[model samples]
Target: MAWVALIIAGLVETVYAAALERSATFTRLWPTLVFLAGVSVSMLGLAIAVRTIPIGTAYAVWVGIGAVGTAIYGIAVLDEPATAARLGCLLLIIAGVAGLKLLH
Candidate 1:
């Protein structure tokens, strides 16, 4: 389904972000490869999902998912700060993403 594709794409976006950071400006080998693959799959999924989902809604959801997911990745694995404010903002984004889905 389009929704499934979209969710996969969104999750892939998180992988893409993490791999990119690990790529070290593309100087690395495996991480750069992973980044490339993640981006390709993510884009394909987004393109497929757009066929059935409204572009505006789909885009917002995709970005929201990516943002929240990547932030969590950064906090959990990358030793980034997990301040209360940052966590709160992530929850807000999650709420907005859920609202968009529920309204759809």
Candidate 2:
């Protein structure tokens, strides 16, 4: 359940990040509010995950998952950089995440 929550928080963080980018003015109260809320949830989940999971392991996994997920979302939804180099980076992040989980 903690892992599930963490993953969900990561995805929500990705969505909010994308929304924030699209919000041109950066002054839009509603979008900014949502983004803050998402960040809060994500951080809370990270805190929970680190309680049971090792700090280094959980933090690495969290950052890895967040980076890969956000990059994918940026590519698919925002049409931002679909280059091979970026894809390779995403693969590396996933590989690292897998290694952490498997070796931990």
Candidate 3:
């Protein structure tokens, strides 16, 4: 259950991250609201998850998920560069997250 919350929180991190960009530094009303809501929910979920998971491991996993998800979103939706090196780095982050889960 805690792990589930952690994963959800990580996913929400991506939402807020992308929305922050769309918010134009919070100049846009709707996207700013979305970013604020996402930040609250994501932090709540992270707090719940940290009750069970180790802080360091949980934080790393959460960040790893957010980073990869945001990068993918940038490439797919924001017309960001999708170079081989970037893709490889993303894969490495995925691998590290997987390794953490497996080791846990």
Candidate 4:
């Protein structure tokens, strides 16, 4: 289930990014710990996934998921901009990710 691992990794990457921001430059102890833990798990998942998937495809998918997921998280929870253009861009990324999965 490398694809499952890869997807989990990608989602965890979003958590890592959010936790990093909450860490406040690493000054916040709890968020910093969460960031560190998230990174460990995320990297482990990615490593497991790459053992089977092509590196190029896996990396591209990973990055695409993280980017889109993070943007959505920011918009929904962080009260970031929810403009139509930004949502459209996220849709594009999702389409690309799906395309990669389908092609592979």
Among the numbered candidates, top TM-score falls to 3
C-alpha lDDT (0 to 100) for residue 97 of candidate 4: 86
- lDDT, candidates in the order shown: 0.94, 0.79, 0.94, 0.92
Model 1, CA-based lDDT: 0.94
TM per candidate comes to 0.96, 0.86, 0.97, 0.96
Which residues of candidate 2, in runs, are more than 4 Å off?
Answer: none
Better of 2 and 3 by lDDT: 3
Steric clash pairs (candidate 3): none
Model 4 ranges off by over 4 Å: none
- Model 3 per-residue lDDT tens digits across residues 1-104: 98999899999999999999999988999999999999999999889989998988899899999999999999999999999999999999999999998888
lDDT of 1 at 37: 100
Q: Could you list the CA RMSD of all candidates, in the order they appear?
A: 0.7, 1.6, 0.6, 0.7
Ranked by TM-score, the better of candidates 3 and 4 is 3
Predicted candidate 2 versus true structure: per-residue lDDT over 1-104, tens digit per residue: 66776667667777678667765567878888877787888898888877777878877887777778778888888789899998988898889888988887
- Report the C-alpha lDDT of model 1 over 1-48, residue by residue, as the tens digit: 999999999999999999999999999999999999999999999999
| Candidates 1 and 2, the one with greater TM-score | 1
Q: Which 10 residues in a row give candidate 2 its minimum summed lDDT?
A: 17-26
Off by over 4 Å in 1: none
